[model samples]
Each structure stands twice: as C-alpha cells, then as structure tokens.
Target: QQQVRQSPQSLTVWEGETAILNCSYENSAFDYFPWYQQFPGEGPALLISILSVSDKKEDGRFTIFFNKREKKLSLHIADSQPGDSATYFCAARAYQGGRALIFGTGTTVSVSP
Candidate 1:
C-alpha cells in the first residue's frame, strides 16, 4: 500500500508564477522527507527536503514547507520555468534505517510561458 500521498495529479502554472505541490504521509515513523524531480526518460533527482525537526527548507527557488504535527508538507517552486516542467515525487524514510523510501503517486507539473 502507498504510505505517502500527493495531491493534484497534474498542475499547470505560468512561467513567472509559483507552483505548489501538496503531500502527506500515513506513517508516523517517517522522519526524513525528500522531494524528487524527474523529467521524461531521466532518473529522478533529489530536489529539496526537510527533516521532521524543521518546518521549512529552502534551496534557490525551491522550498519545502513541512508540518510535522499534521504529517503534511508542500513543495513550492518559485519563478517557475518551462524547463521546470516535470514529475515530482514526495518520498519519506524512517530514521530507524534500512527501510526503502516510500514515494507518493507523484504530481506532474507543467509550466506555461
């Protein structure tokens, strides 16, 4: 069964705007979250992430807003570009180690100029 869930299977946004992707998890044991960005025919790359201890993490135009209490999180892409169009997966892993990362269904983002 899928433990992690992501909203809006598909999204469209303007190039200069921000795109927000929402995620939530069912397992409280999960403490590490890493968002991945994948383009067609390419492997998914690590995007931005936030630990359960932090509420937010930012990298360049990408940001992850986390809510540990609610077991939810969101990825915000600022100043989106056409090149940013890709599928994003929200993945989680437990701190206990040795467990494989659980991924959400993924959100496909489209940036329109």
Candidate 2:
C-alpha cells in the first residue's frame, strides 16, 4: 500500500490563478513532509518542506499547509504561470523512513496564458 497519496492526477490553470494540490499520508511516524517540483527531462527539486511542529510553510509563491492530527497536507501555488507548469510530488520521511523515499503519485500541472 502507498503510504502517501495525492489528489487530482493532473491540473490545468490559467495564468495568475492559484493552484492547489492536496496530499495525505498513512504513517503517523512521519514527521517530515516535503513537496517537490519537476520539469520535463529533469529530476525533482525540493520546493518547500514543513516539520510536524509547523502548521504552515511558505517560500515566495509556494506554500505548504500541514495538519498533523489528520495526517494531511496541501501545496499551494500562488501565481500560476506557464513557466510553472510541471509535476508536483508529496513525500514523507521519518527517522526510520529509510534511504528510499516514500512518494505519492504526482500531480501534473499545466499553466496557460
């Protein structure tokens, strides 16, 4: 079974609109949550992350809203631009999460002007 899951397999947005991506985890031991963005032909890059202690995290236009009690989280893109089009993934980690990362099915986003 997948420990992490993501909603809306894909997304299409207009420029300037905010894009919201949702994620959930099954393991309560997971204390580290990170979101990654990947462009075509490139590896995923760490966009932002949050610890269980934080309810929210933000970096410029990217934000992560976390709910530890519910074991859920969401990533928000503030300014949807064509350049922002890519695949987004949600991952969780614990002290024993191991060298292999637990990844959710990615959400592919397309932004059009």
Candidate 3:
C-alpha cells in the first residue's frame, strides 16, 4: 500500500504565481518530510524539508507548510518561472531509524510564461 500520497497529480501555473502541491501520509511514524524536484532526465534534488516539530519551513521562494496533527503538508513555490517546470515528489522518513524514504506518487508542475 502507498504510505504517502500527493494531490493534483499535475498542475499548471503562470510565471510569478505560486504553485501549491498537497501531500498526506498514512504512517504516524513519519517524522521528517522532504520535497524533491526532478527535471526530465535528472535525479530528484532536495528542494526543501520540514520536521514534524515545525509548522512551516521556508527557503527563499520555496516553502513547506506542515501539519503534524493532520498528517498533511503542502509545498508552495513562490514567483514560479518556466525553469521551475518539473516533477515534485513528497517523501517521508520515519523516526524509527530507517534510511529509506517513502515517496508519494509525485506531482508534475508546469510553470508557463
């Protein structure tokens, strides 16, 4: 079964607008959330992440809004650009000491100019 899930399997946004991606998890053991951005032929790169202790984490134009109680989170890309078009994956790592990260189905975002 899928432990993590993402909504809006695909999304489109105009340049300068914010692109929002939603994610949820079924495992309560998850404590760390990392969002990855992947290009067409490249591996996914860590974009931003948040711990279960915090409600939000922001790095430049990228931000992650997390709600531990609800087992939900969202990634918001501010001032989106065409170069930002790619697939985004929401991944989670449990606190029980496993090195594996459970990833969501992924959300493909297209930033149009």
List pairs with backbone clashes in candidate 3.
Answer: none
Tens digits of per-residue lDDT for model 3, 1-113: 99999999999999999999999999998999999999999999999999999999999999999988899999999999999999999999998885699999999999999
lDDT of 1 by residue, 58-109 (tens): 9999999999889999999999999999999999999996999889999999
Whole-model lDDT per candidate: 0.96, 0.93, 0.96
Candidate 1 vs candidate 2, TM-score winner: 1
TM-score of 3: 0.97
What ranking emerges by lDDT with the best candidate at the front?
Answer: 3, 1, 2
**TM, every model:** 0.98, 0.95, 0.97
User: Residue 96 CA error for candidate 1 (Å)?
Assistant: 1.0
- Kindly report which residue pairs in candidate 1 clash with one another: none
RMSD of each: 0.7, 1.2, 0.7
Off by over 4 Å in 2: 97-99
